[model samples]
Target chain A: MANQPISEPAQKFGERVRARRHELGLSQEQLADKAGLHWTFVGQVERGRRNISLHNLLKLATGLEIDPAELVRGLRRPTG
Target chain B: MANQPISEPAQKFGERVRARRHELGLSQEQLADKAGLHWTFVGQVERGRRNISLHNLLKLATGLEIDPAELVRGLRRPTG
Candidate 1:
């Protein structure tokens, strides 16, 4: 799946991250610093290019100062 | 971090998964089939030995028949 287009869920997750980052007025670099992740990784995550791990998700939630559940709230498996 | 013990958050997440699985009276193999994941992987996840990605997390939540938020609800960053 390398180089394939991002999946819809990934895009949605990225949008949430971007929206939250914007709401907090934090640049990608700043968020990365707070999350102890690379800015490039943060950029990829915000662009739906990375399928982030739970640990990183927690880090991101911490960086954003939100409950970890907030990031994944309302997300569900697409019904057939 | 190779061979390190499971982190507290990972353990908590695993506990939630296991508890939910038990509540539904599903075996690891059954849950794995529902989640479209390998049974060994499901075992690892239940043991907190895997830091699973968001995609897989969704899969697990779907298999467990719960909102994604429920899996992560109440999780927070540990304080110093």
Candidate 2:
């Protein structure tokens, strides 16, 4: 596990969003609407370009029909 | 109850950190050093004045010697 390439936590977070959105068969626009966030903001989040706040994290979790922790799972220390 | 006073999630997050830090007998400066973060950043986070990112969240969790999820538990829907 230590040998795994280090990935930014933001990238992992974005991947989770993409995976969950696909699992729910929801487009970015649909997810954005449900989360009450802008589509561009969703894009930024999904691209790991935004340092999303706790409120937005909760909104996204609610939109994804999951707990907030679920969105943050599997985030291990980044390797060198 | 539904009448519970609405509190921002950031405040709740900060409260958790404060509570946990006290429980662990660690000062903010100590925790900041352990988390490899600035002491001022730790203070800001504890005050709910910072929109902390996932990376920082993990660092805080590590510093607290707790799971990242633990830091976020009990965060309910903000009552309005």
Error of 1 at A67 (Å): 0.8
Which candidate number has the best DockQ? 1
On the 0 to 100 scale, the lDDT of residue B39 in model 2 is 87
For the predicted complex of model 2, DockQ is 0.38
lDDT for each residue of candidate 1 in B1-80, tens digit (9 for 90 to 100): 64442677777788899999999999999999999889998888888788888889999999999988888777764443
**Cα error, candidate 2, residue B18 (Å):** 1.3
Off by over 4 Å in 1: A1-5, A77-80, B1-5, B77-80
Model 1 TM-score is: 0.89
Which window of 10 residues has the lowest lDDT sum in candidate 1 chain B?
B1-10
- Candidate 2 — which pairs collide? none
Candidate 2, chain A: TM-score against the reference: 0.83
**Residue range B19-42, candidate 2, lDDT tens digits:** 999999999999999888898888
Find the 10 residues in a row with the least total lDDT in model 1 chain A: A1-10
